[model samples]
Target: MRALTVKQPWADAIAHGEKRIENRTRPIPPKHLGTTILIHAGATEDFNALPADMVRAWPKDVRAVVALATLAGCHKAAKPRCCAPWGFPDTWHWELKDIRPIPHPPRPVRGQLGLWTVDDDTLAAVQRQISIERTSA
Candidate 1:
């Protein structure tokens, strides 16, 4: 599937489920299109953009975006995504049913909170959806 290449912490957050808003200069594509694979793109560029305050809070923690997802029909945010859930509780707050890790696990997921993908099969499904939506519009 098309990848969103999130940084370390943010990618970890999504994989683990701890962060809510995957803050970005460019917002995730609006929900107007068909379902796109929530790729936990591994760290690409170092998160030098992390605010000083955030760094102070999370000294070792890294930040990446694309972990946050809208529960398909529901707009409520699911639980934060990260191996370390920080100090927060891990609960399915939203209705996100299908979550697939496009690439192989950078690390163990601990538990399969959502669907996981490591190849083109699942990615194709999301890709098809994206293509359909793009053409529809």
Candidate 2:
């Protein structure tokens, strides 16, 4: 499965279903739109970008796949502060849907810059978690 490496609190926010819009400097590729991808929390943290309360509450699960979400659509900000605190002006906002948090994260994997393909072992691990999540739900 494809995956995207996002920095700290932001990745945690997505996993918790608190943030649905991912701000990026580039538009989403047409091929990737509407596709479900893993949300990998990178090793870095954007502490100042989020409020202190949120930061303290969110898990800093770096280098791990925390959730799976569909890239529903992508659009420019169109206005200043478009998607509230999550969206920023002059950036493409990637809308996410069907966000399923992986309650049991797999082993840590190295992250990449953009959308990337997960190795067979990692993909298998994530798939197992998804199966468990579905069964329990």
Candidate 3:
């Protein structure tokens, strides 16, 4: 599965369903639309940079694969809407759908910029985690 590395608090927010749109400087490629992607929380903690309310609602897990979401579409907006609070003007908003948190504990992995491929072993682990989440849900 493909994965996108997102920064700490925002990643956690996406995994927990508090945020549904991911803000980016560039638009996602057309091929990524309607595809499921892993949300990898990057290894950077900036709690002081986040809003106090968000800091208060931080997820227990970080710096790992926290969830899976469908990349529904991507759009550039002059004024932010779905992800306005977390987005800057003139950025692309990647709409997300069918967000699901991984039931198992977060698996640590190094993250890279833009969309990247997950290795076979990590993919298998993530698949297993998703399977468990499905059965339990």
lDDT of each: 0.37, 0.83, 0.76
lDDT of 1 by residue, 50-136 (tens): 445544443232222233233332232335543233322332222232343322332322212233333455335445443223221
Winner on lDDT (1 vs 3): 3
Per-residue lDDT of candidate 2, residues 1-137 (tens digit): 78889988899889974899999999888888878888999888887877787778666788998998888999999864688878888999999988998877775788998889888898788887775232110
Cα RMSD (Å) between model 3 and the true structure? 4.1
Candidate 3 stretches with Cα past 4 Å from truth are: 80-82, 132-137
TM agreement with the true structure for every prediction: 0.35, 0.89, 0.83
Q: Candidate 2 lDDT (Cα, whole model)?
A: 0.83
Residue 18 lDDT in model 2? 81
TM-score of 2: 0.89
TM-score of structure candidate 1: 0.35
lDDT of 3 by residue, 33-92 (tens): 778888998888676766777657557466688888888888886653445665566778
Clashing pairs in 2: none
**Candidate 1 stretches greater than 4 Å from native:** 31-34, 44-137
